[model samples]
Each structure stands twice: as C-alpha cells, then as structure tokens.
Target: MNTGRVVLITGTSSGIGLAAAVQAAQAGYTVVATMRDTTRSDALLKAAAEAGVTVDVRRLDVTDPESVAACVTAVADSYGRLDALVNNAGRANTFATIETCDLATYREVIEVNFLGVVAVTRAGLPHLRAAGGRIVTVGSTRGLIGQPFNEGYSAAKFAVEGFMESLAPTAAGMGVRVVMVEPGPVFETAFGANSGLTRESLLTEAGPYRRVLEPYLDWVARGAHPGAQTGREIAEHIVTALTDPEPPFRVLTSDWAREYTAIKYTDPEGGRVRAMTASWLAREED
Candidate 1:
C-alpha cells in the first residue's frame, strides 16, 4: 500500500485510473498502469515521470481474456509478486430505454466493467495470495440505486459489487483483501464522452422514459457536480485504505453514499429502494 509496493491498475489512460495511478505511485507503489493501448498513455507516463516515479506501462485490453492473462503473467514474472490490483476500467451507457438499445450496447458495457474485473482478478489471485495483498474495484453510487437514463451502466456496477461482496470474505481468510471504492458522479473525469462510444441517444428528444431520464441526468449534472470531490481527493482515500490500521470493507465517496448504504442495510433488505422504484422487484426482501 505504501511506496515500493507493486500495484497493478487497469485503464490508466485517463480519469480515475490516471489519477489513482499517479497518487499510488506518489505513495511509493511501483505501479503497473495498463490500458488498451500503452502507446497512447503518453500523458500518464509524463505525469508519473513528473512525480519522480516510474510506472511500468503496458497494453492490456481487459475485455480480452488473453490480454488479461498475459499482462498478469508479465507482472508476476517481472515483480515476483503483486500487492494490489485496481480494476478501475469501466464505461457508462446513457440510453433512453433498454428496449430501443441494442444488446450489443449492454454487452459492451458489461464486458469491460464486470467481466473484465473477473478476468483480471482471477489471473492476479495467485500472485496476490503469495503477497497477501488487496483488490480494489471501482464502483458507483448507481450500483446502489437504479438511476434514470443509465440502467446499463448501473446494472454492470451492481453486478461487480455483488461479485466482490462474495469474494471479500474468502480473500480475508487468506490474508488478502477485496475492497470496493464507490464514488458518486465526479465531474473531473471524461466518462460521458467515452461512454458515448458504446451508448448513444442519451441526450436526445425525451422518449416515453423522459421523466426518468431528465431528472436523473439533471441531478447527476447539478447536485453531483457541485460537491464532486477532486480526483486527487479520491486518490488520497485509496492511499488511506492501503495504509489504514483498520481499512473498511468498502469506502464510500460522499455522505449520500454512506446514507444510502445505511438505508439499504438498516431496512433488513432493499425494501425502501424497491418501494421507491416501483418497477423494480423485491426479490430479496428480508
């Protein structure tokens, strides 16, 4: 968790991945920054150089299982061990309705966000167990509650959280840890633009789903933006988790995130959530 620790991070080209890698390097971790194309990671490389740390930049498309396996193998071979794996590579889908959106759109989102973590974590397990390290997966507040226009993205994150909740207990037994970093909408990143590549029709004419679409995007734009923590601020939180005397199982980014998690747990089940989102099912009401 500190400097000299060997950490591997996915999607280091921009946004949270970029910020986290820089901060982790500054914290003294020998960072391995992976992207779809390392040749284009010029900015991230420059940032690390400026910070006086050398990051092992490599090309790793997480969606490709072969790439994931190879990169992780390279990590183990070069470092002899890995202390942490940060699965911060993900994209959002801002469609008007699931009906109109093609299956390809949903697949694209899930492949990169959900399955990518599974692939990478599975590959990194042996090295991590040998080092008794940690796994940090980036999640969203959207994973907690169904937002309006971004169902696909939310679903993907929801799946990730579910997977980690199960994986954490097993990891703890082995002296390894699994932690989820849940952040609210932070304006510092370029998620929307990159998401546009996979999911289009987000800001189009209000469809039948206009009610859900407008309010959610507005809330995301206005409410979340003003209180959006700096990329550096979020980075520091990770540093705390890595070095804490007793790090939390999950680190929530905002007061709202904490309150919402409290509500979900305090309710015995997600009763409040299902009741509010009437269309959603109360399949696991406790």
Candidate 2:
C-alpha cells in the first residue's frame, strides 16, 4: 500500500481518470482528482464513496496555463509533496483527413493531449523527484500507428510518445519514472461523446471521404472488436505502473492493443501495420 503518498490525476470527471482516482485512493494513495469543471464530479465522488475511499476533487483546465499552474500550486501548498501524476486529460478531433483538418482543430488536440502533459509534468517534477515518484500519461495505440481520419489526435499522441521517450531517460537520472499507458478503443466511457468526436457527427458528413469513412464507422458502430477494455481495467494497469518498482517506459493496456502496436514497432519495414489496418477498412468497405 502506498499509504499517504499523494497522486494528482487530471481529467477525473469521468472515464479512466475517475477509475484511476477511486482505485488509487482505495490502494491507500492520497488522490487529487481534477477536471475542467467540478460540476461533473458527482460520479467520481459517488465512486469514491462506494469504494470507501476519499478523493480530493478540484477544477483544472489543462489547456489553460494559468489553471495548470494554479492547480499545481494549490496541490503543493496543500500536500507539500506529490508522489505521482497521471496526465489523462485529452481532446480528440473529429474525423478528417489531413488536408481537410483545420489548423485550429489540430491546435486544440495538441493543446490538451501534448502540451497539457508537458505543463503538468513540469509543474510536478520537483516534488516527484523528491519522492522518486512516477509520471504516467495515457496515450493511445494511435501513437504507434496513425489511422486515416484521426490525423490530429494521432499526431498529438505520437508527439506525446516522442516527448516521453526523450524525457524518460532524464527522469530516470532524477529517480522519477516517466511512462505512457496506451489503450485501444476503450468502452463504457463517454469518450466519443465527451471528446466531441462521435462517429455519427463526424462521418455522416464526411463528404468526399464518405465512401471509406462510412464503412469504418459502421464497423465500429457494430462493435466488431468485442475485446475493448473498460475504464476500470485500464485504470488497474495504470495503478500497476504507478506501484511497480521498475515499470516499463510504455504500457499497452490490452492484449489486442499490444499485439497491434507490436506489428508497427517490430517490423523494420514499417508497412505491416498500415497494410493490416488498411485491410480492415477495405474489408469493411467491401
């Protein structure tokens, strides 16, 4: 048990962040769960109560530098030390090819998914180093291989993977663990709804790409891959990463995600993942 060790997690209003907070608290970690708005905290509070553990919920808009600095300052003032930080706040762009994606859309996703992690980590590094703590950021399988219409989101995650890979070695020198937990197509979360990237809203009006996008969206709508993990399962893997003495630099949360990402990284040719994913879309279209 990490009794009294403080862990600050972003995006705890729902999904993986909420579960991670509840689970970490139950495991004896003092949890600080922050979301953009506190009004959405009801579900997290309820889950903490049900788990018989307490979580300190606060408002933190990760995209805003002021909010990030103020939240970190408040945490430092209150707890004086932070043992771990879970950078889970992310924004996904609606489906669009690179050519069609607006610059503002790309910036929005990068602001939350990439820069947000950097901001939070920078603010928490001193305290984390003091405790030899961990930094776990929730990335995506898309970080390994880009999907056709997910350019903005995928690019942000890829940047996160690159940034963390660069920072991991330096963080190790400071006795701090920096890791990325990559998950694929998680279910039981309003991520699509919350991210403002629902398939219907994006693909229904795909225009020129409708022929290819519709099939992919239909397959997803039909739930072709039933092995998608729940938020709690992903959170459990995150907790393991946090507690393990020597955790991996990157954690693929599901067997499926691991297998698929392996195809991209293990193959030096770098064509296998593209071919395989393209086949899925082609088959669906057919």
Candidate 3:
C-alpha cells in the first residue's frame, strides 16, 4: 500500500488515465485524477466507486502552462508531497497523410500530445524529485513504427519517446524514476471516437490517398489487432511502472507490443519497418 504517496495523473476523464487512477488508488496510492474538464469526471468517479477506491479529481489542462502550474501547486500545497506523475493526457490525430493534413492540425497534435507532456512534467519534476518519485508516460507503438496516415500523432508520440528516453537518465540522477509504458492499439478508449472520423468520411476525404487509406483502414477495422489491449490492461502496466521498485525504463504492455517494437531495434537500415508498415497499406490480394 502506497498510503500517503500522492501521484498526479493527467487526462483522467476517460480511457487509460481514468483506469490508471482507479487502479493506483486501489493499490493504496493517493491518486490525483485530473482532466481538462472536471464535468466529464462522472465515469471516473463511478469506476473508482466500483473498484472500492477513491481518487482526488482535479482540473488540469496540460496544454495551458498556467493550468499545469496551478494544478501541480495545488497538489503540492494540499498534500505537501508528490510521489509520482503519470503523463497520460494526449489526443489522437485525425487520419490524414502529411501532405493532406493542414499545418494547424499538425501544430495542434504536437501541442497536445508532445508539448502537453513536457509542460506537465516540467511542472511536476521538482515535487517528484523531492519524494524520489516516478514519471510514467503512456506511449504508443506508433511512436516505435510510424503509421501511414497518422503523421501528426506518430510524430508527437515519437517525440515523447525521444524526450522520455533522454530524460530518464537525468531524472534518475535526481532520485526520480522515469518510465514509458508503450501500448499498441488500445480498445475502450476515446482515442478513435475523439478523432470524430468514420470509415465513410475518411474514405470520402482521403482524395488521392484513398487507395492507400482504404487498405490501412481495412487493416485497422479487422476487429482487434494482435497487439491490441484494453485501456484497463494498459493501465495495469502504468500502475506497475509506478509501484515497481526496480521498473525498467520502458514497459511494453503486451507480448505482441514487445515483439512489434523489437523490430525497430534489430532493423538497422529501417527496411524491415518500411516494408512491414507498407504492407498495412497493400490490398489483401497484393
């Protein structure tokens, strides 16, 4: 039981964030579950109730520096200590090739998915260092192997990978443990729905890229992929990363995710990844 250890999590209105919050609280940590809008916290509250745990729900907009600072300050002031930080707040980009995606969309994706993590981490680091705490960021397989039509999202996640990987050692020097929990496709999350995209709409909007988009979407729509996991499953990994005394720098949520990302490490010339992801866009007959 973590007891009085206070852990702050961002984007807890739903999905991995909410699950992690409840699970962390269940595991006996003082969980501060935060989201941009507190009004959307009903689901999280319900989940916590069902889990026989309670969480401190708060409002935190990671994209806004003031919100980030204020939330962290309030947590510190209220608890007098912070034990961990879970960077789970992020948005999925609408499906579009780089050439087809507007610059504004690209910036928005980067801002929320990448810079938001940065802002929250920067604000929480001091408190975390004081308690010898942990920083667990929810990473994606798209970060390891870039997807065809998800240019903005993949780029942002890839940036997160680099940032966390580089900061892990430095944070460790300050008695802070940083870990990245990499999940492949996650089910029961707002990720897909939040994109506000459907197969028909994407197909119609794909323009010249429809041929490629069709196969990719088909691959995605083939029910659950081998590496796919539920948000609860991914949250379990996050909680482990938070509580494990000697957690690894990277936590792959599933065996499939481990095997999938392993390709990048072994492929020196990037040929294997290029060929594999390209296959996702190839018609079945091809």
Candidate 4:
C-alpha cells in the first residue's frame, strides 16, 4: 500500500490508464482518474468498487487546452498537492504513411500525444515542483525506430521522446524526475479498438493496395491483447518509478526488445547479425 499518496492519470476510461488507476488506488494512493466523461466510466467504477479502493473519476479531454487545465486545477485545488502524474492518455494511428496521410489525422495525433502532454505537464509543474515528484510518459519502441506503416504514431512518440529529453535537466533542477516507459506489444486492451486508423492512407484511390490490407489489420488486432501486463504490473512499475532510489529513465518491458536494443547498442546496424553469428569466437575472446 502506498499510504494515501496522491496521484492523477489521464485516459482512465480503459486500457493502461484504467488499469494504472485501479492499481494505484489499491496500493493506497488516492488516485484522480480522469476520463473524457465520468458518467460513462462504468467499467472503471465497477472495478474500483470490487477492489474496495476509492478513486475519484474526473473528466479530462487531453486534446482540449481548457479541459487539461481544468483537470490540473481540480487536482491541485482538491488535493493541495500532487505526488505524481502518469500521462497515459495517448493513441496509435496505424497504416498512415507520410506521403498519403490525412492532415486531419496527423493533427489529431500530434495534438493529443505531443501538445496534450505539454499542456498537462506545464499545468502540473507547479505542484509537482512543490512535491518533488516524478513524471512517467508512456513511450513506444516505435519511438526509437522508423517503422514505415505507423508514421503518425511513430512521429508523435519520437517528438515525446525528444521533449522529455530536453525537459529532463530543467525538471531535475526543480527536484522533479521524468521517466519514459517504452513497452513492446501488449496482449489485451482497447488500444486496437480505440486505435484511430482509417481507410484514407491504407486504402487510397490509387497505389499498391488500393484496398486496405486485411491481413495486416488482422495481425495487429490479434497482437495487442491486454494480458501482456495486467493492470497490476503497470501499477507496480509506476510505484517503482516514483519511489525507487535509482529508477530507470527508460524501461523497456519486453525481454527480446531489451536483447535487441542491447545488440543494436553494442554493434552498429550492419554489425549485429554478424556478431551474433559467431558467438563462440566472441566467447573465446572474452
């Protein structure tokens, strides 16, 4: 139990944000779980009830500046201090290549993922500075690589990574720490369901696949199940990031992803496969 620690998480209607809120409340934190609408958060309310933990459900639309500011004000005014903030309200836009993407989709993605983060972080900076707390932004491995299909999602995440890196020094000066959790594919969640993909780019009037690729859609649908990390695991990690003396600035949740990153780090892009090919020779040298 976290002994009534005060925290806030955006996008609490479902997926990672919902789970994180439940877990935090269970851990004895007084959580302010903000969805776009509180009246519609039946699942969250029911789950919280079952767990016997009380979490305040508020309304927050990250894309709207007024909504973002209001949520921050509500938290600070009501709680008098905020211990931590988990900016988990985000989306992934698949099948949107740069050459063919709708400008509207790109704007929506950047507004919510990049600008929304800035709005909320700036609003909370005062209280976070007072509490000397931590900030956790859910990033993606795609943020590191240039995946062709997820251009919009990748670009937004890349911007987030850059923004976080730039703010790290200033945040540290205020005794506020920032961490980015880079997770690989997860098993279950509303992510795929809520993923704002459309036929604009994937099914253009002209091009290779004049129709959207059904097979690719099928693969993505099956891959993003929520069981990969239960609502509890994310909560535990969030707690660790808040309290751990030497919390990782970047935590990659997948084992293979870690191994892959390690390989990429040790050997240049073209050198990893060859390095892995001769394990015995490397071992002999060691």
**lDDT scores in order:** 0.78, 0.86, 0.92, 0.74
Worst 10 residues of 1 by lDDT: 277-286
Per-model TM against the reference: 0.87, 0.94, 0.97, 0.83
- RMSD per prediction, one decimal? 4.9, 1.7, 1.1, 6.7
lDDT of 2 at 166: 98
lDDT of 3: 0.92
TM-score for candidate 1, residues paired by index? 0.87
Off by over 4 Å in 2: 196-200, 283-286
Residue 234, model 2, lDDT: 95
* Top candidate, metric TM-score: 3
Pairwise TM-score winner, candidates 1 and 3 = 3
Candidate 4 per-residue lDDT over residues 1-286, each given as its tens digit: 6575688888888877777888888777889999877886998888899988878999988888889888889888998899888888887665655556678879888888888888888888888999888888887776765444576887888999899989988998999999888776654567766764464535553265433344444444555333255445565666667667677788776675576456546666646545443331232224
Clashing pairs in 3: none
**Candidate 3 lDDT, 1-286, residue by residue in tens:** 6588999999998899999999999989999999999999999999999988899999999889999999999999999999999999998777998777789989999999999999999999999999999899998999988988989999999999999999999999999999999999898999778778898998898889999999998888886387778999999999899889999998988999989989999998999999998998999898
Q: What TM value does model 4 have? A: 0.83
lDDT at position 264, candidate 4: 48
List candidate 1 segments past 4 Å from native: 1-3, 197-206, 224-226, 268-286
Candidate rank order under TM-score: 3, 2, 1, 4
Give the count of colliding residue pairs in each prediction.
2, 0, 0, 6
Local accuracy of candidate 2 as per-residue lDDT tens digits, 121-156: 998898899988999999998888888778888999
